[model samples]
Target: MSYPHHLGMTVLEAGPERTRVSLTVTPSGLNMHGSAHGGLIFSLADEAFALISNATAQAVAVETHLSFFRAARDGDQLVAVATPERVGRTLATYRVEVRRGAGGEVIALFLGTVSRREKPA
Candidate 1:
C-alpha cells in the first residue's frame, strides 16, 4: 500500500463489510479537458473496492468494470462508497459509486469482483 497517490485519500468510514473514502479533485488528477481523469476516478472506486473486499478475508481483484456517468472537475470533493453485493467463501462482488460530495450526483459507477484465497499452508 505504498501508493503515494492514495495518501491523499481520506478514509471517512471503515466497517467490517463496507467502507467510504473521500478526496478532493486536484490538478494532478485532471485530464486535458480540465476534468477529473478517468484513471483517478477509477482509482477512487478501486480504493473502496480494496477496503470492502478485503474487510474480512484475503482477496485479490479478478475483474473490474466501470462506467462513467458524469465528469467532475478540479476542486470538486468526491466521495466513494462501497457495498457488497455478495460475499462468499471464494468469491465476492462489490458496487462502488463515486459521487460529487456537494450535489451527490454520481460521477462514476464501478463493479468489482474478487477471489478470496486461503492462507498458504
Candidate 2:
C-alpha cells in the first residue's frame, strides 16, 4: 500500500497544479503534548505536494519547509491543499496550507520545491 494509505490519508481532489488531501488524527498520530505530531502534519502536507507536483510530470522533492500555527488533537480532521507558486522546465515551487477542517482554523503552512524529471521517450 502507498505511504499515504498507510497513514489513512485520502485525496479529496487532484489536478496538475492543485490538490487536496485529508486525514483524521488517530491516537497513534499524537505527540506527547496530546496534540498531532509535527511529522504527521508535515506528511499530510508533503502528500498533497507530491500529488500536485507529479500529476503532469515526474518530479522529486528538492526542499520543504513547514510552519506550524496551531495544534490539532486526536480525532481532529485536517485537510491540506496544495497549489503551485511557480513552475519551470527544471524546477517548481508549491504552497500547501493545512487546515483544521473544511474551513477551519489554519494549522500549518508548507512550502516545497521539486526538481522536474524528463519523461522516458
Candidate 3:
C-alpha cells in the first residue's frame, strides 16, 4: 500500500542531508480559530524529517519537537526546509525550519531524531 497521507501534503524535495517541502493553506485546513492547525504544521515538519532522515537509508523517527512562532492564514504558502544536524550509523538528527514563503516570515522551528533500521536479511 502506498503512504498517501504524506503524498497528499505535496512534499517537494527529498535528498541527502536535506529536504524541502511546501504546504498551501486552505479554508478546510484551518482550525476553529481560523488559523492553520498545529497538527498540520507538525505533519509538514514530520514529513520533511522523514524525507531527510531516510535519504541515505531507511530510518524511523524516535523523537520530535516543534515551536510555533507565528500563525499562518488561508492562502499562505508555507515552506519547510530540513537539514541534517547530526548523522551517525545508528542515529540521525535534523532541524526543520518552516516559514511563510510568500512573505518570508518564520512560522515554526522543529527538531527530529531518527534511528536507522537494518535491512532485512
Q: After superposition, how far is residue 33 of candidate 1 from its true place, in Å?
A: 0.4
Ranking by lDDT: 2, 1, 3
Cα lDDT listed for each candidate: 0.87, 0.95, 0.84
Cα lDDT tens digits, model 2, 1-121, are: 9889999999999997779999999999999999999999999999999999998879999999999999999999999999999999999999999999988988999999999977666
- TM-scores of the candidates are 0.90, 0.96, 0.88
Query: After aligning candidate 3 to the native by TM-score, how far in Å is the CA of 89 from where it should be?
Result: 0.8
Clashing pairs in 3: none
Off-target runs (Cα >4 Å) in candidate 1 are 4-7, 118-121
Write one digit per residue (lDDT tens) for candidate 1, span 1-121: 6552553788788765678888899998899999999988888888989988877778899999999999999899999899999988899999998999934999899999999976465
Q: Residue by residue across 77-117, what tens digits does model 3's lDDT show? A: 88889999989899989999998993388899999999997
lDDT head-to-head 2 vs 3, winner: 2
Best by lDDT: 2
Best by TM-score: 2
